[model samples]
Target: MNNPVISVQNVDAHYGERQVLFDVNLDVMPGEIVVIMGGSGSGKSTLLKHLLGLQVPTSGSILVHGKSLHDVSKKELKQLRKKMGVAFQGGALLSSLTVAENVSLPLEYNTDLDQNTIDIMVRLKLELMNLGGFGHLMPAELSGGMLKRAGLARAVIMDPNVLFFDEPSAGLDPVTSVELDELILKLRDAMNITMVIVTHELDSAFKIADRIMVLLDGKVVQVGTVEEIKRSDDERIQNLINRRPRSNQLHGDAYLQRLVNGEGEK
Candidate 1:
């Protein structure tokens, strides 16, 4: 990855005494779409939080555009955040604000731009997202897919260099999910933004990712192109792709011990 936009180096994360991520490492290049995929308890969420600078790693470092985040000042971190954008899984829109107002919130709080300029920029982004006329509508008035699009519009409103998404296709129908995948590809290309997505949705990841990073048991199991992943002979990878239920012999005593020791919490 030449001129990588993100670099994670031997990162290990912990929750209390239990380590959740084990020596994770990856790099994301400019204008590329990288998907981080794993099932529940795979430590994907922990990785995302670390990348967003919401938590510090217990060991190792994360660098965004060559700026180390482990011990950066708050002001410096805020400047780095200004170059990043996130589309949460829930489409977290404020119910009281109109779509246009919601979309304008970033520019309103982050810049000295006036109402007229913010509104114009908001409309432009909404139009780019295929929601130009819907800006006047409330978030409640939007369908699930439309709401996701609205969220995407707001995320890219700042023209961020790195865009992150969490489960962008979680609740939508298949067709809607596919449509959103297309929109994601379009946004990365048109805006020249590096996209990092975390999801359990295999189809969407396979369709949209330039490279896929697979995780298991708090460690990266594999990182490969879509075709390479399909060709993988790893049983874990094959089981995940096939959605095959496992008959792992987890003894009842071990399960009880985990619960007794409070090790079940993620």
Candidate 2:
């Protein structure tokens, strides 16, 4: 493609002796929504950390806007990170701070804006998340869904070009999860921001992904649109999409029967 906003080239990540990601390569275009999906221990989150520069790659390189993480100076990395926003899995907010305070934290550290400007910015972001008057409320006072929304508001407060969401639908009820998915779509369309979502929720993945990357055993098994994935003939892809039990899938007919029965019960 032309110039991807984020690119990963043969990235391999390791934690001590354990290899976490193996030769992962992917690219995210500007204004696109890409979903990374896989089962637990598939290295989806590990890959996300690499993308965010929290964890360095053992081999290969990660680039944001064409600048390699390893090549960038610490000062440059800090500035580059400010250009992106991240909504963690559980809305990692400050327990002691109010909603507005949390939202303004980034501006406080990254900009020279005065208090009045910061307050206005906070209000704008909170209002965008449909949380106009909840600014004064503590994190404990907000519900789980509200907390997620508040965290999203904070994430976008700096008007970042890229937004990273780690399991946005986790810990949410079905209806709430759907609402959050819609919100993600709206953000992409209305704000023209590139979004990278890390999620294992198949329904949510199919609902929001413009492109899907499936990770397995610390490697990318497939990367394509949802339809392409659905039509894939790869055994690993099929098993994952069909929700077959991993251990039993290698055993043949009896396991297939169990998978059929289990899916029917759902």
* Total clashes for model 1: 0
Candidate 1 residue lDDT tens string, 1-266: 28789999999999999999999999998898999998888998889999999899999999999988877888999999999999989789999999988889899889999889888999999998899899999999999999999999999999999999999999999999999999999998898999999999999999999999999889989999999998999888888888875447669998889889988475
Where does model 1 exceed 4 Å of error? 249-266
Looking at model 1, the pairs that clash are none
TM-score of 2: 0.92
Q: 1-266, model 2: which lDDT tens digit per residue?
A: 56999999999988888888989999999998999998889999999998999888999999999999779999999989998999998899999999999999999999999999999999988888889999999999999989999999999999999999999999999999998899888888888999999998899999999999999989999999999998988888887888986664346777698787785341
Against the hidden reference, what TM-scores do the models get?
0.93, 0.92
Native-referenced Cα lDDT, model 1 = 0.92
